[model samples]
Target: MNDKTQDIAIVGGGLAGASLALLLSHHLPQLKITLIESFPLFNSDNEKSLPSYDDRSSALSLGSCRILQTLTIWSQLKPYLTAIEKVHVSDRGHPAGTLLDYRELDDISDEEALGYVVENRHLGQVLLSALAQQSNIDTISPATVAEVTPQADEAQLVIRQGDKQQRLAANLIVIADGAHSSLREKLGIAVEKSDYGQVAVIANITSSGYHDGVAYERFTDSGPMALLPLGDFNDEHRSALVWTVDSDREADVVAMSDEAFLQTIQQRFGNRLGFFTRVGKRHIYPLALYKAKEQIRRHIVLMGNAAHAMHPVAGQGFNLALRDCSALVDTLCDATVRGQSPGELDVLNHYLSRQDLDQEKTIGTSHLLTLLFSTAETLPAFARNTGLFGLNFLPGIKAWFARQAMGVAGNRSQIAQPASSTAAEKRIK
Candidate 1:
């Protein structure tokens, strides 16, 4: 294609793109990786959209923890992470609730947490830092991909950086630029989208007492509200809150005063952690289910939000993307070690095929959770409450839910291996 052709060129330096580069570089040291981001890597002196570096919070399932461990950045991330030892799920005003405890999972120790919650900005910083230290990985920032042309052997990209425009070529191109990826459109990939008619409002909150590392998922008439434990703040326990509300009410919710908002949250979430005394800057995003019709096309592959974006009900969006990252790494590294072309249609297709089942299960689960918890309909509400009771009533169901919350259930890939169990054991020691 060109004198400077790359082995793999990734578009978007967010979580998926950055992690993919690091994972592949670590496993296949012989291959060269180039990562391109349309926005600034982080908040700079100059104002720019730093999507990867934001105040948002993400829950990392234990399965996702293993993938990070495989990439070798988990150790650096552990200090700042707050463990999710248990997930307390309930419907507002309903006595019936489900507790997906880590102890429910077989071989899972009581000390081991089901997941960890970290600010997206912190995790992104860790991944970006790790990427920077990789000798085989090249990072590009504040650049835009004006176009992508896929040829028989390689894909070409027209990138615009500042005032200069250049043509770059690669054996394969990965698109991970989030839900509204322009490169995906340039490649003529269609997305199947369903709007949930809701918006997610996120903020940091503090309670009167300790959270004990328990995450709360409370379903109200408005929607599902999640308060993930985040250690503490100024002698008060802190948590990250994600509340889904009807699109029509989003504006009013966002406009509320902090004290009034806290009162409303207390009313909806009950006195679980005592009172939500303080609230921080709030952010909101419209909720929807968006899936790429085709995950891979010839010399290109889609990843992260570009591949599939679902509701944040289960906090599986980034977790699923990390799993997709692991599957791609496994497939490509195996093929490369065996002397196969990573850009081959068969190679890309294999990655897509393996991810399909996981994506299906995750997307379906999130959609069903959103529907069941958000609806005020009597029948669906009754069934949801019944399902919550089933989690505790049936051992098999409790174990299954625990596995899902731990992020170890669906697929068995090299990345999703029980390596984290070893880490958990070490933690216990």
Candidate 2:
């Protein structure tokens, strides 16, 4: 490969794109990288121009934390990391309620938390900060896409960064934009979208009681609500809330205030997490499941939310996206080692084949669980709660569920690296 031609184009400056740039740079320092963002540049402190991640936060699995730590970016956002030592789940008003302590799982260690919660801003900033350390990465913003015409060997991208536009060619183009990615649609890519008729009302609340690193998820007839702890932010006990409400309830949630919202919050949320004291700003997003028809198309590939955007009930979007990041990076890095064109069909499909099982299992399971729980009828509720309560009596079954949640139940060989930091331990397949 010519040094000048060994460049990859990343179309998105979100967490997924920035992480991909850092990983590629870490593995192949000689390759050139061009990262583009449609949003204009601005300081993080400019509230007037800032976009709100709202009360929204992401829970990163241990596997995800491992990836970020390997890139040396975890320390940048450590202050914001809320380790989830245990997850308490229950069905309000039902006979059976379930709370899962990580200690029950023999596979998971006692010291390691189940996951870590970090706001999106923290993730983006940390990723961008890590990108600055890479000499080969060229980050650009306010970029307009002129064209994305796929060629036999490479996909040509004409990106207008500012006044001057450059005709850049990349061996591979990775798309990490959200569910409604215009670029993916423009490229004639097909996608499967399912509307759940649900809205996720999110907010951050200051709780009077300490969470003690416990993340709570309760499912009521309305929908699934998650109370994720925020690690002692500003000397206050905080937990991010994501409540999935039906279309009819969305209007009321949007109009609620700190005082009025607390009333409803207390109704479902028992005294377990202490009093609901104060609430920060709130935001809402419609829930939907989207999966791209194909993982790879010629020289173009979609990762992150662009590939599959699931309902937040499972908190698997970013985790699944990170798996994509690792798989793609490994594939390209291994191709480089073998002196083969990374964008070749054989090479790209090899990566896709390794990821297909995991991709289908997570997305399908997400949709399936959503359908099963959202049932409003009493009979369905009885059956589901029976299962939840039954697991409490049987420690064996609880361990199985715990392992599944930890991403160790299935054959995760595609995303699992050997227990070593040496580059040679990384798997090509």
Give the Cα error of residue 403 in candidate 2, in Å: 2.6
Off by over 4 Å in 2: 1-6, 45-55, 162-164, 413-415, 418-429
lDDT: which candidate is best? 1
Candidate 1 lDDT over residue span 386-427, tens digit each: 998887788776776666656677666786786645544232
For candidate 1, the TM-score is 0.95
Q: List the residue pairs that clash in candidate 1.
A: none
lDDT of 2 by residue, 68-120 (tens): 66666666778878898889888888767787765555444443567789987
Q: Candidate 2 vs. truth: CA RMSD?
A: 4.0
Model 1 poorest ten-residue lDDT run:
420-429
Give the poorly placed runs of model 1, Cα more than 4 Å off: 1-3, 42-49, 109-111, 420-429
